[model samples]
Target: MPILGEFREFIARGNVIDLAVGVIIGAAFNDIVKSLVDQVVMPPVGLLFSGIDFARLEWVLKPDNPATKANELVAIQYGAFLNTLIKFLIVSWVVFLLVKAVNVIRRRDAQHPEATSSAPPPQEALLMEIRDLLKAQAGREEPPTRH
Candidate 1:
């Protein structure tokens, strides 16, 4: 029961939930990217290469033998690999752009720190209150007033 409770607590963590959501979204995004590569992007590229279908591009290592019990063709599918490589490049480029945009926004925020938030962080506000209390206790300043 304790182990179960611990497991429940672990699953309830914000980061765990966020990770789960990220994985689900990532899987869906991968499907979208795959479809984009296989259906939309590859066709035009294939056309440029004289009607060559990238998915069907392969090197036959061992041709299928009808006499064998298992008549299976062994081949290295390089065309599919090319399509996957393109998908990877597209995904990486998009991620790079998103990170760049986020960095720009963060840089802007850092340049104008006061505009980022109206209130100080909780720790800063608490420390300020403590400083005011100490000054008042030492008879060096007037008592703090609430805003």
Candidate 2:
């Protein structure tokens, strides 16, 4: 097959498509969680902590020098790290919830296979009914009388 056709077939496979979709959704979800942590969640927490800004919370290793126009300044931004940690935790929790929901749906569908698929064909249904009727008749038959 041609290279284009081969590429098309690979992309069309279920796992590949699902993975691509997952990556896209994960990226978007990460962005949303990051935004929530940065804007909504942290602000209130910071306010509760005496209006502290987490992003600006850092340790200066070398102070900035404006006399020599030297931009050599280093700092450890532990607050930013905390914000990122919170975002990660939130995203993890959301993923866990989603996975739990999917597992529940899978279990339910497994328990009731008919829910996921259409009913048996008419002939199959009729055969099952006949088998049940024959079993019923066999059960109803009287035992042979003793001599």
Candidate 3:
């Protein structure tokens, strides 16, 4: 197939669309989680650690030159890293919970198959029932009788 045709085929798959939507929502969710970590979760934790702002908590590997302010300060921002780690944990926990819930629902649907829309149509179901009945009747040793 042509390259454009292949691209079209790829885009047409349901999984691709689902993945695109997931990525978009995940980005938005990431922002929310970041805000929660920055505004709500980190403040009390920082207060407990005696007024340390994680974003500003950095070690100056190379001090800035006060003479001319020519060379900028280079530092390792470990506090920001800690905040990011907390955000990662929160997001992971949420995703885990969502997956667990989906699995539970999936198991319930599997056990009660009719709970989902995967059941055959009424016409197909009736045909299957008739086929089974015919098979059972055919297995009998008795001859058929006309009513």
Deviating ranges (above 4 Å) for candidate 2: 119-147
Residue range 42-136, candidate 1, lDDT tens digits: 99999999999999999999999999899699999999899999999999988899999999999999999988879888999999999999878
2 against 3, candidate with superior TM-score: 3
Q: Compared with the true structure, what per-residue lDDT tens digits does model 2 show for residues 1-147?
A: 999999999999999999999999989988899889999999999999999999889999988887878687899989999998898899889989999999999999999998899989999999999999999998999988999
Rank the candidate models, highest TM-score first.
3, 1, 2
Where model 3 places Cα greater than 4 Å from the true spot, the runs are 117-147
Residue 72 lDDT (model 1): 92
lDDT (Cα, tens digit) per residue for candidate 3, span 1-147: 999999999999999999999999999999999999999999998899898888788888998889875778899998888999999999999999999999999999989987676779999999999999999988985877799
Which number leads on lDDT?
1
Structure candidate 3, residue pairs in collision: none
Candidate 3 lDDT for residue 68 = 79
Report, for every candidate in turn, its global Cα lDDT versus the true structure: 0.94, 0.93, 0.92
What TM-scores do the predictions have? 0.74, 0.74, 0.75
lDDT of 3: 0.92
